[model samples]
Target: MDTALQTKPCRFGDKNTSDIVICLKNREGIPKRFYSHSSVLINKSKYFANRLSHPGSNNCIDIYCSEVNYDHHVNLLRLLDLPTDSILDSFDSVKSAVGILQLAVFFQCEEIACCCIQYLEAVPWEDKEEELILKAVSKLGPKAMPILARIQPVDLAATKDVFISAVRIATSIAGPCPPFGNELKTSAQEQVEFMLGEDEDAPLVTADEEVKSVLRMGLSQIYSSFEKELSSLLLEPDLVSERAEEKILHSLCDLEWMCNILGKMDLMKDFVSNWAESSSNVLGVVENNKLDSFMWGLKIKLIEITAKVLEAVGYGNVILPTPIRLTLLKTWLPYIRKMKPLLDSKGSQETGFPYKMSEDLCQSIEGAMVTLVLALPSNDQADILADWMGAEQVRYPDLSEAFEVWCFRTKSAKRRLVEGLDGAGNATVSL
Candidate 1:
């Protein structure tokens, strides 16, 4: 130890060499001591400099005063005594840092807040939580507004309003407001006039350019485009006005095309798996009930996307083989089955949240899911439909709806009964 210490250099505030204690209170109001040095704390954090300036700031045991809970404050103080080069590398670290940042802002520690702001601008977040962090950072004064231009779509996926606000502030330009309702108002007379007139030379936009613009958009814009299109279709009395969520659906179509073109089905599978996990539920920035929206969870998006992609009759421009198509369908069953209660007539009445998809939406979604099932290769269709109610864990089968879907879509509904799932004759399959 003597030889190694003498041979190598040590950075500032190496561990265990402490002179003062930073005290944080536990839930029971007992003080816990975290080691720190006056020089490092004063130099790195201005709050510590002011707090330690007066001799009375310390208790009899060299414990400097603090009121923030030990859970949130310990890491912030500990970081001060460590080398500055250490980076927070995970999503949870960023989430915790956001909490600690509140403390930093409270104590007038501009330096610590600046570090966190920089970290947040560069990190990938939980998509739904970016607004909370951005809102907090905006209150920190003028120095932090530039981060809006740097916020990626992944950070603003669920909150494009925040992203657009940041862009407007950073660029100092106002864009046109989006009109109400999902569809664009169109005129056939104007289209004819424009097609025949000299305006043809006025920089006509190409399909390639249009698609590039869509691609450049972050997740927020893509989702908005999709959702808007979806609304337009749903609002129309004609159930077939157009495809729903085209931008998202096609952006994914483009991915599927690339995956097939490159022969990377395994990679696509892995990507969807990760996408499914991160987007499993619509979690809010600080909500504790993480899976509160299970019926309309992130998995719903996957299911809808799969239904869009699996249709051999659509203008997808890419044809996924039956097996590949089946993989996408199977991936979403576990998630959709979780919504079985909400799908059942008795269970649907029991739902608490009002925003649950309407009866029309439920029917539309079920119709699409059933269509995708029936579109499966003749041999795979029955198995695919049956798997929705069957999983490793034993739960009450909601084949009630699944059976209803089969009855609606197939001629063999009476012959192919959803029986023997629970090994009891009490398990009935009536459509």
Candidate 2:
């Protein structure tokens, strides 16, 4: 072994310089080691030797180390006085790059981790690289969030199978081995929450101009897919109705996912707002039947998702476009108007109404109305609601209790919506 390799174990560690030296010497078929100090030695020795060594020399080191061995890599980088960014640039594969990022995070090397994450963001999400990508993300854990954010514009629909595969892989990465093992399940949940939240745990990496360009392009592609899907569903109401409720549910679920992604970008707000408008238009076309039920369900989802977007925008300090308010009110007005008869119709003996039918109908309508009202920009809508309340109270004086119940319901809804919208409004105003 060379004198540099033979030096006292202090630099590497006290216990086993021989094993370290042996690992470095043979450099063949090393099955992924995670020794903290070994990463330093391997990185340092390679750097000095690489600088002085011949360009075509076959004397290069090949060490197997987990991505989590980044702390050691950082120490090595420091010892050899190498720019961490330059060291990251040496990685020729996503796996290697991710491994270095994992180490950078593990060793508290923020700048290097940021750089590696930026690099990962530049590469497209390929089907063939799913496993490698998952492994790298798993090792980096929460620190990988920034990279995940950067890849938001990738064509998930084109890579739907791969994307689903990645989700499964991410679940596995966050696992407890036995399906829903406690540790893994908890980790996975935390990861989902972190990625979904505006206040993410990971720091945002400074992306290059090309990465930014690709992200914008990718996001536009995603929006196109969304537009295409929405258009298909709208044009073929029969097709939507023909599909099983579960299938429709699946599409809605995917929309929810898209909403989350759009929520992050700040660009998708208009798309989502437009979706709400289009959803309202379809509600009119839908006649009373199973199709109506599906449309109602979809409308409910839109309402919920719109609220979430508003909340997110408020947090991001992004001022919502004015049209959102008008679009939201227009979308919801028809549903509110439709609820009136449903609330008034009394059960009869010939064509029996279901038990609690009136009450349940009233509640559903009230809930939907409240959600709609809250989503509005709260200018003079209180008078509109008050007028509706007074008219209902007089029309159903015999059912004064129901009227009071409706009023209470409206009040509760108003409070909740106000609180949510107010918070969001404050955020927007501040921003």
Please give each candidate's TM-score: 0.33, 0.34
Task: Give the local distance difference test score of model 2.
Answer: 0.48
Query: Positional deviation of 32 in candidate 1, in angstroms?
Result: 1.3
- Could you give candidate 2's per-residue lDDT for residues 1-431 as a string of tens digits? 35654464333333453233212212344443322233344444444344325565332334444445534454434433344546555656676666665556544555666677777877766676656666667666676787667545545344443333333333333223575454553454345435446563442322345433443444444445444555456456464553633444444554565455444544465545555556554454443454443454554454455445444433434345546644554455445454334423423432554322244444444444444444444343454455546563333212334345556767888899999998987784433
Residue range 1-431, candidate 1, lDDT tens digits = 13453354333334454556665655556776665566666677676777778778762133333454445576566555445455344225666778767767866666666677777777777877777788777677765765666663333233343333432322212323355212211132133223323453542222243322322332334334334443343344433222323433444443333223112112233333323333322222112233243323332444444433333212223445565556655654555555445445434566563333345545544555555565666558668655655665424323355456556656564335544433566666989
Q: What is the C-alpha local distance difference test score of candidate 1? A: 0.47
lDDT of 2 at 256: 62
**CA lDDT of 229 in candidate 1?**
44
Whole-model lDDT values for every prediction? 0.47, 0.48
